[model samples]
Target: MSMPEPKTAWRLLKSAGVKYVRFVIVDIFGRPRVDILPIDEAKDAFIDGVLFDGSSIPAYGGVNRSDFVAMPDLDSVYIETWNGGKTALIFTSVMDGSRPSLRDPRNVLKSALETVKARGYKPLLGVELEFFLVKGDPPMYADGGVYFDGHLLHTWPVLEEIMEHFHLSGIGSTKTHHEVAPGQYEVNIPAGDPLEVADKVLAFKILAKSVAQRHGYTATFMPKPFWGINGSGAHVHLSLWRDGENLFASVKEPREELKYAVAGILQNAIANSVFVAPTVNSYKRLVPHHEAPTRIVWGLGNRSAMVRVPYYGGRINRLEYRHPDPSMNPYVAFASIVFSAYMGVEKRLEPPPPVDTVAYELEGVRETPRHLGDAVKYAQESALLPEEFVKPYLALKEEEWLSYLKSEGDWEKTWNKITRWEYNAYLVNV
Candidate 1:
């Protein structure tokens, strides 16, 4: 069930003793803006929605027609994990009059999932988010631990608190541990329906940051927060199901449906890179020889390939897309992936054979687009991404790239330095 009616939802909250509600909406840049509501007004806010000036939100709208409303997706209502149940939080999808707003990230995903369900299938997703804990202006690592470090005494308490909040928020964690890089960490959450999974991903980021600050360190999801060290990435594990059976897995060979989905993703990989790695710094994490994928190829357990079919067979089998970073808007990112898979299923396309060797060194392999400009160009010209979505997205990305060009920072001063913009923009906010 998506959710109960607004009155029922508000009544449930009232029964739980929630005094305040925060209606959240994520913008194209992956920033969450909230509208606070008292318990008395929440029911009306849900039924009629809350008005906001869309022009004030970056890339949302212009002055000519900037008014928009945020109607809470009641299915997404949950107690604020960090706020002790006194407050509840719900996500919103922008609406223009009675129609879904094309500019809203949640609406984009919702529309795509509706199409997938109509085709008699559901998209299941398991997300792995990697981030770092640091402090200071330039930032010093919070811990010197390495991958699976057994002695992360300093980091454990923070992670424990973060995980506790996640559990309270109803976001189940399958695994959590330190990553290979200093102060880096990873969290694995159980798979679910596409929209719910995306919402959880967003919530996880928010809670992770909130809990980290409570400890005295800043948590960053910036794709490449530091130079000469491993960068963070949010790898998405994708699969499709129908009537509780995984369509991507078969008793014998990989299913034909799985093959088609891979083909669709590869077909649109370049164009959709903007959705996966949306920020300028994301390209810094895509360098070859790193764990990140830079080429458009699939493999079995190969970290260097764009997509990898893990060794797990049967119901657990799925495709892991390696390019996306936690910096992306999960709603839009998942929508693009599933919609691209739809194109593959519709065409019955076959993907190129999976390569077993190191794909980064493999000759004739197509590189995933290198820079934001190339990605923006490919996305604008893509036939798969509808004009309504691609148009505003491209405009926003273009402005981001141009802004970076005019920006003069420490990176420009040093021949090889990471941009300070990423540090200032994401270190505290993300």
Candidate 2:
């Protein structure tokens, strides 16, 4: 479905009985922040914005330059699904007076989408989001169900509610299923324009957790919620379009455009690792034998390859980026991939031979960063992340890594099934 025309947004809200409008925006760390305004004052969003003190937000800005504007994107307006549709939800891009903030994650995605548009193409994105539905407010119990089991019978009520909510929120999901790990589930949100897909990803997480709460369960999207289990990943499926043709689809072999895009993604995988795997716990999920891709390689229908081209043809053909997890900011992560592909198209970069063997078992295959510190060091040396973002992002990630190092003992984290510290830090908070 297309975004509603800006002039009709207010009318639609009123027709839907929206008593309030929630202006939403994500921070550098991908945390959702909001400011609620009465429906009567909603028109002010289109004029300027609802002002807020940005300095108080984590790692956003300081008091000296904290004054900021959150200009709502009317095209993104939707009725709140988890809240009985009583609230109108609209996403915002941070504004420093009249200009978009360079640090805003959503604006970064918009900039990348513009580059694709300039090339006479549009990016289409679909995301597979995975999370755990553990018991307890602090999440001490893992639902006693295995992969693809009849856990559907146990959790179908909540899953059904989630599906209904996704549809009502205008972010329709393609599928929902019991995942590999116990208490883990995967919800596949339908494909859309790059910017909208990112927005929907943020929205889905918020609404999913809220719904889980109402169902007496806490949904956690932490990359590795428990030790020695399958971790959650936000595996992205992407393809480019021009007018009506799928650029990734080829009659034989693969198209030049597809080749160049794959080349760009693989070439920058290590440098862009920090954005793909943003947290300390993210690395815990990236280790070998965990069903997560750790090497920089691509192959047709290969789950072990970092980039997998499914064995399908025609318009449905696309690349599945398997490296990213749910912990990173979807906006930054998706835009970074687009920018890398942009470089590939412009430079006509070539991809290496597709690895037919398991990439992790291959003797000399290149690996993604093994730790947060390693990812930061590699990002520091690369230009994939815009110059404005590197300094602040590096500071934040490095601080997280240091805190992890000082807090956890290697033996306990590996053998004791300890989650008290991790749960307190990330559960329900991130």
Candidate 3:
């Protein structure tokens, strides 16, 4: 996709009758921060770029070197009608001096995409964003609906409003349905350019929260907000294209490239866990028997495996990575998946035989990291990501893990159940 010129962006906003423009940036932890400007001031910001303190954001910079600029990707401009169509939002790229910051989550994914493009392939991503809506201080489910329930539940109207917002914002939301757990819902974003898809995923979360709040509820992407029920997952559907052909498609069985990509993902599953199942509470959702992936294995149409090749046949065939939860930073998660898959293709790595039956019942298959500390350790030992990114990410995650430990001493005893401390720490913030 080509980026729009500054003049084009200014004209588009003016034509839309936008009174305020929001310069949006995603921090390392996947939280979005915004700076809103009146239309007149924003016109100048489009050319000069918006300056902010990078040190305030996690993993960006130190106090001494805190200067940074947010250069809006004009093509990402989207007008929101919730505020009477007066507010326009644009996703920005963080700039360190004159160059893009490697620490910027979006730029990391951009670098990974360029690497894939140089090897004659274009990657496409479709994301399924799952989250829950609740109310009250400790949080309670807003509805009693189950999977595919279409009843006129309290949460249904919120989902409808969110979808309407997505449509107005140019996000292609293909499907929305009630998930297995109460108050849980999922929205499927159609396959598109990886970067655009990531932006939509982030936008979906923000919109869901906004719409839910207007209805007197809170929307959370927390992986495991409650125990003994299914947790929210951000299942990613990935496909690779070269010369306008789907590289993973085949008539009889799985293709070699598909197997190699799965192998690369499985090989780095341990290290990649930090990016996918990112939060301290994310590990709680990776356990078996809750429709979540626990084993690092792949199979055809197997939901239990971390990587499952959906039987779509022909050009539509793709892999579904089920390990990731909505708590992840989509930009970094997609980048890690692309880099791992590319590594497999470059090395010709072969995946293990497909698990035909229940993978959780099978022994000997490698299990994903059981805790955030284990994920941090595995990431520290691997060279999967660049040193600059990996160093700060590990430090940030390590601190998070230590804080969790401090809050709930002896995690081994309380790992099975969601504690009050865990709920207080992550329920609202995540």
Candidate 4:
């Protein structure tokens, strides 16, 4: 949906009996930070924006430039009524004084989208997010269901309630079902504008967690919450359009732009690893034979490949990037994908032949970074993303990797195990 005028949005909220307005901003770590004000005082906030201490947020700004503003995006205005309260939640565009902040994840994505638009292409993004629901202190599975299990009588009600909240919030969820592992579920969000798709992804996480808690369970997006079971992933599907025509459309074989896009992603897959798989536990899910992509390869409808061109044919054809997990910031991850694809088009890069067989059984293929430290190293050495974002992001993630080392010592020794420290650090927080 298009953005309404500020006054019109305020009036809509008031008419809906909204008692409070939530100004939401996503931090670099993909966590939502919110500030709520009564509906009566929200009119001014819509105009002038809300002020907050930016220094408290990681990588936002230092103490010297602590003041930041969150200007509400009217297109993102949605009323959340799941908690038995009328609250209008609006995503914000972060600002520093009179200009946009380079550190803001939303602004970073906007910048990438603008770059793509300048090249006469409109990028579309669809996301499939997988997560798990558990109960108890240490967190055990909430259900014993497997993939596509329809008779989850005890668990289907929770998913139905979550979908109801999504409908109320004006978010589109095309599909919802049990994932491969017990207590794990996947939600498919239809393709749309890149920024809007990212917003929907964030909103999905918030709503899923809220609904889970209300049902006496905890929802987690941690990539590898369990050691033996299948880990969760957030698969991203992308397509390029110009003059209302899909650039990657094809009947049988993939198109040139599609191959170029895949080439670009494979070229920078290692560099983009830190953004897609941001946490220490994320690498555990990337191991060989875990249904996760270990090599930087592309295939035609191959699930094991990092990038796959699903055999949809014609206008619906798109590239599916399978590396990202739910722990990532959608804004940053989407931006990186767009930028990489743009680079491919500009350079006319060609990807290697598509692998029609299992990529996991293949030899002599470039593997993804083994752990968070390796990803950080690759990110530090590469110049694929914006310098402003890469600098501070590496600093924060490097520290996180160091902390893991201090807490768990060597990760290789416990490579096959999910240590207590990992659960303590990432279980619910990620």
RMSD of 3: 1.5
lDDT for each candidate structure: 0.83, 0.81, 0.86, 0.88
Q: Please tell me which model should have the higher TM-score, number 2 or number 3.
A: 3
Candidate 1 Cα outliers beyond 4 Å, as residue runs? 313-316, 408-416
- Tens-digit lDDT track for model 3 on 62-113? 9999999988987677777655789887899999998999888889899999
As for candidate 4, its clashing pairs are none
Worst 10 residues of 3 by lDDT: 309-318
Candidate 4, poorest ten consecutive residues by summed lDDT? 308-317
In terms of TM-score, which candidate is stronger, 1 or 4?
4
TM-score of the candidate numbered 2? 0.93
Candidate 3 stretches with Cα past 4 Å from truth are 312-316
Candidate 3 colliding pairs, count? 0
lDDT per residue as tens, model 2, 367-417: 988778889899999846556666787888888777776777553354325
Clash totals, every prediction: 0, 0, 0, 0
The candidates, ranked best first by TM-score, are 4, 3, 1, 2
TM-scores for all candidates? 0.95, 0.93, 0.97, 0.97
lDDT of 2 at 373: 82
Tell me how candidate 2 scores on lDDT: 0.81
